[model samples]
Structures are given as structure tokens and as C-alpha cells.
Target chain A: MAKPACKNLEEIFRTPHGAVYQCNRANCFWLEFAGGISAFKASDFLHLKKQVEQIDVPEMVQNTARMADIVILNPFRSERCFVLTVTDVLNLRELLQGAKVMLDLNSMLYDCLHAMAV
Target chain B: MKDLLRLRTSLTEEIETLLNEQIKVEAHSSSVYLAMSSWCNRNGFDNSADYFQKQSGEEREHMLKLFGFINDMGGRAISPEVTNIPQEFESFRAVFETALQQEIYVTQQFNRIADRCFKAKDFMSFQFIQWFLKEQIEEEYIARRALELFDVIGEEGTGRWEIDKQVPKIKYEN
Candidate 1:
């Protein structure tokens, strides 16, 4: 037996800034953002999505403080840190939301298929 | 390709979100009960304070039970940050009234979650919450009985003292 040289990745969602992929072989999600790819387990991915959704976008836009210009996310079990600006946060939110909807659709479809198979 | 999402968790995203919200509710209820305990203690209602402290601990136990279930099902269980706990009471009677109201609210929340579980066809989660739904009956009964003591004892001269003494004795049998 031979292991596949390339990752068995399925594109979940993509935007001009980045994209997300589901790695079937690794059983994790690959986030293509900030000019690199970072892997997150399913739970970690959902956690990241929640963190992104909680960002105060309006406050970020209104606050002039240098520290308030960006927010950082350090995903669990990953060395990468996402330092996101207001625009980056918006883009990431869009990406993650799209991916979540697709994942939910996939699950529903799977249930339907399984029921039909039976 | 593999169904990675299904492989990751037995809970649907909707059910998981509802469970997390319920976790927050439980944490909030625990904090509220602890605040009530402190108010009762400060007002010289020793037995009532002890009763509320016990209620607070039970609510925390309920929260941990939900937390464990979420994690066991492979869903992310968030440790909720509770806020807005009231520390002051208007009067002695107000405390038991608030307790009864809080129990009612908790029962309503559990009913909503159970309904959502049924709609989503998540029978496992529905079955898990039945314990809480049934427990709410006893909780509401105890709180209601404690409140009714104010009317029975007549909060005039020694009524408050008598009510405080009897508060801890109130129990839900069967």
C-alpha cells in the first residue's frame, strides 16, 4: 500500500482573500488565509468560527487606538496566529459562514442518502 | 470522500448551539441563586441563606452535567461567563418571589430546548433533557411552597422570623 502524496482536500469555501478546505484524509479543516494554510480539527474550526463571529466590527472601525486596529486568533493545536484587520475580519467571517452552511448542507445530504440506501 | 462533520460529532450544529445557550442559562441561574443566598445571609435569614446556597450548588451541578454531555458527544462545550447577578433584595418576601420566578424561567428554557430537540429529531438530546424537565417540577414546587409560607405565616411581627426558620424545612416529596 502507498500513501497519497497530496492532501485529499475538498474546497469548502473561497474568497479573494483566502479559502477553506476539508481534508478527508486528515479529518480536519485547512484554512488558507494570511498567505498560508493552517489546519484545525473540526471542533477547533467551529471554535475559530465563533471567535471570528464575536469580533466587534463596528467598534474596530470606530476606535482610533492603535491597539484596536486588529484582532488576533491563535487556533488550538496550531502554531499559526491570525492577526486580522477590520476588512480581514469581514472576509474571514464571510468565508467561515459559507463553509458552515455548506458543511450543514453536506450533513443533511448525507442523512438523506443514508436513508435512501436503507 | 468521508463525512468528516458526522464523524466529528453526533450533535447537529443547531443542537450544539442550543445546548451551549442552555449552559449559559444554567450558569446564570447558579449565580442568581448564590446572590440570593448572600442577600438572605445579610438580612439575618440564616436558614433561607442555607437553602439558597444548596440551590446554587445544584444548579452548578446541572451546568456541569450539560457540559459533560456536550463534550461526550464530541461537541465544543463553552464555559459560560455569567453576568448581571442581582445582589440586593427589596424585602424578605421578595427573595422567595424571585426564586419562584427564576424556577419558572428555567423550566421555560428547558421546555424550549426540548421542543427544539424534537423538531430537529435529535432524540438522544431530547432524552437527555427529560431529567431536567422532570427535576423542574420539584424545583418549582419547593420555591412556590416557600413563597406560600409568607401568606400562611402572615408577615407581621414574628412572621418573617418564622418564615425564615421554616424555609429550609420545605421539601418536595416524591
Candidate 2:
């Protein structure tokens, strides 16, 4: 018989990014790291560092910052993976204000989520 | 039993048609946003085009939402047949005004669908339409606000750049 499906969010996080996976059941999480492993690692690390700094920095940094919720786990052997869930895109806008950023990662993340919903 | 079966069949057909029409509307909305994006690009409004491109994605999301709903209900969602979208606009104001009109039309369409579901005693479908009804209100409000901003800038001719600068600040929520 086929193995029982992984249904929990933590079980879903076990699969590494960039691997083809599917969660066919309702209320299950499916992580699709469309980009290759290196890119996913870099983005995930950057987001984690940003989240950590936002949470720990001084009041000056805290005053103009918002951090997205992130879950990090060792999915595959020695491969650290992270997923960021943003409830409010507006909070990101407040965080990025007056900063000279090249690409809008917040918008990209929002689009990625929207694509998944579709 | 025969009469009840006929009534059920008729109700199913009607609901199917309405659902298909909604799919077409969503597709048409995507095309409309694409057209608006192209117009903005040609008119040196890159930020506006970006906004419309995001709007196009949202429209696709709307189509998929309806598609999932229909499939979940054991109903077939027909492929949408979208008309050619006009790519030219006289001004930004005109574009937004047209968008506002389309949102109003879509709200009316949703209301009609809700009414039909009520008549058919399909409370589930009627309840599902409530989300779209609420969304339409915000959609119209945004378009109307854009129109009002256009009027304000057009009247003064001084704040156009400022308004254009603000375009990039618009937020897109998933």
C-alpha cells in the first residue's frame, strides 16, 4: 500500500524546496520551491535574518519595522528550509519605507501566494 | 416525484449557466486589466501598468475561485470566451471611469446570481455570492477613488506628478 499522506503543516515542511510535491487533502500544506535549492536557501536565510533583526533590534529599528511569520525546519538531510507567512502586505510596506530596494520581494511573495491559491 | 425531479434538473441547469457566466466575467476582467496595463505602459505610467498587471492576476484568481466552487458543487465550469479588450484610452480618468462602470456591472451580475439562487432555494450558492458582493463594493470604491484623484489632478494640472509618484505606493494584498 502507498504510504499514508503527510497532512500536518510540519510534515508538509519536511519536503525540501524545489522538489515536486503535492498535498491532495484539504487543510494540508504543499510547499513548492519553484526556484532551485541555492536560490531558495539564500532567500530563506535572508528572510530569517531580517525577521530576527526586526525582532531584536533597538527601538529605532523596531519603530519602523514589521516582520513576517516564519517557520524554519531541517526538511531534508542537512538542508535548512524556511517558509514565511505574511498576513498583512501593508506591514511590509511600512517596513520597507524610504529604503532603496531593487526588487519588491514582498510583492513577489504575495504573487507567489496568489499563484498557489489559484 | 417526477415534478420534483424536473424542478431539480431545471435548477441545476440555471445554476450551471450562471456559474459559467461568472467564469466569463472573471476572464473578461483579466483582459480588461491587461488592456489597461498596456495603455498605461504606452502613456509613460509604468507604476499604473504594474498595478493593472497585479489586477490582472487578481482577476485570474477570481476565475479560479469560481472554478473551484463550481467543481466542488459537482457542476462543470465551461471555458470562458472573452472578447477583445480595447487597448486605447483617452486619459487615465477615462480608464478608471470605465473600470468603475465594469465593477458596477459585475456587482449587478452577482446580485442577479444571488437572486436566482434564492429563487431556486440554493442557499449555499447564495451564501457563496456574498463574498463577491462584498469584494465588488471595495473594487468599485477603489476605482471611484482613482477617478476622483484624476479629476483633482486634471483640474489643477499641478499635482499630476505628485499623483503619479503616489501610484507606486498602492498596495496589493493576497
Candidate of highest lDDT: 1
TM-score of chain A of 1: 0.92
For every candidate, how close is chain A to the native chain A in TM-score? Answer: 0.92, 0.20
lDDT of 2 at B87: 82
Off by over 4 Å in 1: A1-7
* Candidate 2, DockQ score (0 to 1): 0.01
Q: Which ten residues in a row have the lowest lDDT in candidate 1 chain B?
A: B1-10
Per-residue error at A90 for model 1, in Å? 1.3
Query: Local distance difference test, per candidate?
Result: 0.90, 0.59
Model 1 has a clash total of 0
Interface RMSD for candidates 1 onward, in order: 1.2, 24.4
Q: Give the TM-score of candidate 2.
A: 0.54
Candidate 2 chain B minimal-lDDT segment of 10 residues: B1-10
Report per-candidate DockQ: 0.68, 0.01
After superposition of all CA atoms, the RMSD between model 2 and the true structure is 20.9
| Residue-level lDDT tens digits of model 1 in A23-82 | 887898888886878889988898899899999999999999999999998887998999
- Clashes per model (N, Cα, C within 3 A): 0, 0
Question: How high is each candidate's TM-score?
Answer: 0.92, 0.54
